[model samples]
Target: MKATEVLADAYERIAEVVHDAVEGLSAEELNARIDPKANSITWLVWHLTRVQDDHVAEASGLERVWTAQDWFTRFALPLPAAATGYGHTPRQVGTVLVESGELLLGYFDAVHEQSTGFIRGLTATDLERVVDAGWDPPVTLGVRLVSVLADDLQHAGQAAFVRGALQRR
Candidate 1:
């Protein structure tokens, strides 16, 4: 299969697993503390969606999808005026506001759907073109897409781990 096709397939599979992971969770369960070092299921879902939005912007040369100034503009989230910070805690990252696991997963799937469309619109030629992503070495569209996919898979594992810990509690 071609590289674009491979990326699309990988994204679809990753999204499916994410959907399964949050299947039966309630808002409280979704927001439950997994561990001091870990995030809740809701946080993982939002983080995945945000990751996709950032990746899409990088790969398509577009604007950032979910800005800190408007975190709830999409996915039916309530907008927050200031939602940016850096730290290890879920609160520091603002992952604590995710009220419902179902909503979080649904929003994530929507982002995946849109991301797949964005990916499909690209040509193989589009993939190899280099862009100034404001990084030290810069990056290609294809590289960014691959990075998004890898990050998604990695976080999916993290989400599962959180789920397992929740089960243990």
Candidate 2:
């Protein structure tokens, strides 16, 4: 398989887990935290989606789905317009509650559409281009995309775990 295909597949896995973790869950379940300081399924999915929307948009030189599509307004969270849930504390995490699983899935699916579209068009040379220069060695498009994929997968898995735990509670 091509490198782009592999990347797309990796992201697709995150979407699968995201959907599984949130589908049919009620507001209370989605927003439930195992501990007072723990992350909720809602928060995990939203944060992962936001991070993907932010990073992929930056690397592709495209507008973030969050702002470009007015998702920030839709979410109405008491956070910055560009908030990606990075470094968010427990209180901040609780503020990411959604009315339903569908809202989270809608935003995630929108981001996935944009991310996959941008990624599928990239060549090996495109992947080598520096997307961020702040890092010690500078960050290439490939590295940045991989980083987002890893983060999204981790959060997705966390959401799944939270779901399982909540179900068994």
Candidate 3:
């Protein structure tokens, strides 16, 4: 498989894990913040979904989905000026309790669909193009894609921990 294809597959795998972890959680369970330092499952899901949306927009050279819609507001988090950072803390804002699992699932599903679609359209030459964030060193699209996929996977593992914690409670 090509580089972009691998990234898409990686995202799908992570999504499946996260999806399973949140499957049986009620609203309260989804928002359970066992450790303040670590984000709850709700926060992890929102943050990861936003990243996927932002990355797809960046890769396609289009406007970010979050900017077009009140995604942060919908999640009841403080909307950042741009998609540069995490949208909001689900645990702090208590929006997760207000949002049903179905709604959150729909948002995540949309992010995944858009990201996969963008990745599938990328050529190897496109992946080689560099994105200059101007903070650190410039990173190629392929590298950023891999990093984002890895981040999502890490958060999925965290989500599993959140689920286990909820089950125990």
Task: Give the number of the best model, judged by TM-score.
Answer: 2
Give me the runs in candidate 1 sitting further than 4 Å from their true place: 61-90, 93-95, 133-137
Candidate 2 — which pairs collide?
none
Of the candidates shown, which would achieve the greatest lDDT relative to the real structure? 2
**Candidate 1 vs candidate 3, lDDT winner:** 3
Error of 1 at 65 (Å): 5.2
User: On a 0 to 1 TM-score scale, where does candidate 2 land against the true structure?
Assistant: 0.98
Q: Where is model 1 poorest over a 10-residue stretch in terms of lDDT?
A: 79-88
lDDT of candidates 1 onward, in order: 0.69, 0.92, 0.72
Clashing pairs in 3: none
Error of 2 at 113 (Å): 0.2
What does candidate 2's lDDT look like per residue over 70-108, in tens digits? 989989999999888999999999899899888899999
Question: Cα deviation of 154 in candidate 1 (Å)?
Answer: 0.9
Candidate 2's C-alpha runs over 4 A off are: none
User: How many angstroms is residue 59 displaced in model 2 relative to the true structure, after the best TM-score fit?
Assistant: 1.0
Using TM-score as the measure, name the better of candidate 1 and candidate 2: 2
